[model samples]
Target: MNAKEVKEILDSAKKNDVFLMEAVWTRFFPASVEIRKLLAQGEIGEVKMVGAEYGVPLFHVPRSDQKDLGGGALLGLGISCLQFISMVYNREKPESIQASGICLETGVDESVAVILQYSKNRMAMFTCSAGVHLHGEAFIAGTNGIMEVLSPMWCPTALVVNEKVTQYPVPEPSLPLNFTYSTGMRYEAEEVRQCLLKGNETSAFCLL
Candidate 1:
């Protein structure tokens, strides 16, 4: 029941001359994008571990805690946690992936904690919860130092690079409204627009 046929879509895009990509907006966030650059510069000195957690009290929310209703922690909040891992590693092949979690009344998963072991002893640990509120923060910890993303890591504008913290002003949405983390959604859209206009199917940020 995996609706996203990523490889199929990628191949189609190449053949049809049309652009296609997953809507993983987190990948376009300033904080997530910067983390990759900083890592390439060896800012973290070879990331050995990545820890991220995302959760909220949504156990009663039908889309999160009801199996027949497509309820599950992994689909609801786990993608963001896994995004942190993808930001640091090539997930095409993991050395090993271990998962354990709890099931809600509807037989759907309420919480999931995953451990991804990779080559060179690199590893990642992340958790998603539909029953409680986590700090909503994520980090990339390496041998030299650690990079901490701001809360609600999914749409963060700031990041704490080692001891020095850097921040970006929350984006103002086109349609004025109270503050929303999703304001950063524009970054993703704009990246896509520019990519298509340039006739480039992908870029570092847009490829994934």
Candidate 2:
């Protein structure tokens, strides 16, 4: 289905009293909660900047060539990066957005790079590609140190303060597969339940 059609379906479901939501899974997980806690407790200090990227090399796929299918790096991966930025900054929209990309044969973007500027001199750099394998990592830089989230989409395992560029101990595992890993999706669902219980429509963590 086209992007517009998908949006329409979601709207219809919402109107019909159904819990219709886009499956943006990262917002509901343990990593997100920990990140939120850190931000709240000033663990990483004041968040000064954010950088994230997501990309995949879909070179020869037919659906990847169709603009009508929302086939492009911007829609595919850029949205995820944007979501990360939005979540970290408390769902505030960027004050300004500057984006550029390359259009491939089927009039779909092959790659894109965007810069989003937010309040308090905070900014985020985002990139996406359908032409190359991406090393997806997200970093939130603060006054004290930095918080690094590896694989922001699926398993957002976080890293604590690395004081020096010297050697550091191996990071411990954050979640177990199917058990704790599934907590990501469940956390988000619980957020929805809490919001409804509180007579709210949107979640503070995963607001769209």
Candidate 3:
């Protein structure tokens, strides 16, 4: 959604006095939580850059090439990289964004690369593709050391900081799932439950 739409939704939710949350599930995962904790503790010193990539062969998927269906590598696959970058930056606005993409005949992007420039020399770079497969890893580089999220970073179960590894598996799902690590969704649900129990109108981690 655009900025105007997001603001409108936030306003409406506030006016209605109802709780609002965005299901950015990764933020609720244990590994994701650990990332924030480590950053806060200065485990890697001042973070200067974040690099991420997530790509899969989706060109054969019909919806992926259709503009009306919101089809595009950036929207369908790249959101993960974007979300991770946002989380690392705490949603701070980037001073500039540079992007490039290769579009399909159907007018949707098939591959994309982006660079988000933030203040204090901090920056984020990422790439996403619908026609190719990528390792789906992510890296956060800091003055002291570097942190890395393993492959499939969007729903990662492991992280490496300064060559030390940590793993946090998701709870098993009650039923079959179409996506990997979808069981992590339970974490997001529990967060919502806790927020409501506390009588909060929004989640501090993913407010509208």
Candidate 4:
């Protein structure tokens, strides 16, 4: 979906006075909370750049190469990196975006890379792929120090800031999960619940 579609949805939600939110669960993680706290406290100074990478071996999955299935690296997996960038930039519009990618024979992206340039020399870059497995790491660089999100940055459980490490383990789920750290989704659920209780129409951490 494009900006027009997103704007329409937001407008509709406001007109109807209903709660609306995007389920970008990573932003609800404790690691994410810590990242925000550190930034707010100026522990890392002024953020200059943010970088993230996410990829997995999904070529063997038939839907991964099928355009009709909405199959592509950018659509399926790249959201993690893109959302991370948006979080760091506080949803500010970038000055420009440049992207490049490789596509499968079926014409779906196999690997994608993007660069977002913003004012004051701020920038964000990321890579996502379905053709290969990446290190799945991310970093935020600032004037004073840098912070690194550990592997599987999308659902990160740990972060390193200037040689100091902080870890947030996933909670145990009652049911089995198909992915690692999925129990962290509880945080997202609670966020929605609390918002509804308070008659909120949107989340402070995630905009409509």
Candidate 5:
């Protein structure tokens, strides 16, 4: 759907009794859930900072050049980076946000970097580019050690704790099209289901 339509639907859901939300599939995955638990349990100690990056070259897509389609770094890669930060920080929206981007020929953002400051002096740096190649990984730095999410956006196939790299196998989900192997999306669905069953409007990681 178009941006207007999507916004309307979200509004409708708020007005209605349904829980409407953006489909941020990565936040719901098993690895992500585990990461949250690790943080809560102090396995990673006090989280001091986080760093994440996501980007894609939109050179081949015509819509990428159209601002009306929300074709920009903020809406595209920024969304992904912000979503990643929210998930890592247990769905807490940043207390403050500072951002800047480079505009393209179509007046859309070609690339952007955003700094999010949270409570307890915790900070997250997110970056995205529609004009460059990027290794989409997220890092969580704490006092004791660090946790690394490799491919945190889509497959989310592996996670490394500190210096010891432990890989979790991605479960094959029976889904459609290019989403069949997506462990991230399925995990999010599971979290939603759990929340609904518990009569909770939000997940433990939900900011709102």
Candidate 6:
């Protein structure tokens, strides 16, 4: 998992007192910011569970089906699910994990489902698939109400809160996928630029 290498890099970065960050652009999305606010403001009560799924039909691509080239649904889409959970629950590692997946001949996973249990009875269930076309939806359920991150949750343009279906709008691309991203990536880049200008080691919104 390159865990050791990542740790070393972080340690080195700290020792050198430099800024280093992982490229998870979702954190900078307006929808993401709104979700954080909703949780902090107790709009959804105390979050007890989070579910997320991101899948696309890309099995025909060489870079996706090849193991040596780091092809797998988990490697491709699971990070976003992990990020979604962290955005809700912070950076604490899951206390227990359960996973199952289907793999191709190259031993690369075509699909993966993982359930991560955290302390305080909180849980996160995430699924990523390469052979399927999923809605890329995410759900956050709490004691009082629930929040749904719209389709393509990783870069969604809206969030639906509660049974009343109260919609909170987020910024959308001037033209969908105009810059190779349905959700404009400029917001994240701008955040990074601000951090650099402020000499901050990491973003206040998006953590590595």
Candidate number with greatest TM-score: 3
Model 3 has an lDDT value of 0.92
Query: lDDT of all the models against the reference?
Result: 0.80, 0.73, 0.92, 0.92, 0.76, 0.84
Please give the lDDT score at residue 156 for candidate 6. Answer: 67
TM-score of 3: 0.94
lDDT of 5 by residue, 110-204 (tens): 88988889999999998888888787888899999998888745446688898777676766555554743554555778778887888765565
Relative to the unseen true structure, what is the C-alpha lDDT of residue 173 in candidate 2, on a scale of 0 to 100? Answer: 44
Report model 1's TM-score to 2 decimal places: 0.88
Ranking of candidates on TM-score, top first? 3, 4, 6, 1, 5, 2
Report residue 75 deviation for candidate 3 (angstroms).
Answer: 0.9
- Worst 10-residue lDDT window for candidate 1 reads 60-69
What does candidate 2's lDDT look like per residue over 1-208, in tens digits?
4678877886786687655455677766666667777788998888989888887887677777788887888777777787887878888888999989899888989999988899889888888998998877788899888987776444465544444221222234465555335545566677778877876655555543
Put down candidate 4 lDDT per residue, 58-151, tens digits, no spaces.
8788888889887899988898899999998888999999999998889899999999999999999999999899989999999999999999
Q: What's the C-alpha lDDT at position 193 in model 3?
A: 96
Q: What's the lDDT of the predicted structure labeled candidate 5?
A: 0.76
Ordered from best to worst lDDT, the candidate numbers read: 3, 4, 6, 1, 5, 2
* Model 6 spans > 4 angstroms off: 15-17, 164-183
Name the lDDT value of residue 25 in candidate 2: 72
**TM-score per model over all chains:** 0.88, 0.77, 0.94, 0.93, 0.82, 0.88
- Model 4 global lDDT (CA atoms, 0 to 1): 0.92
lDDT of 5 at 20: 50
Find the 10 residues in a row with the least total lDDT in model 6. 175-184
- Lowest lDDT block of 10, candidate 5: 175-184
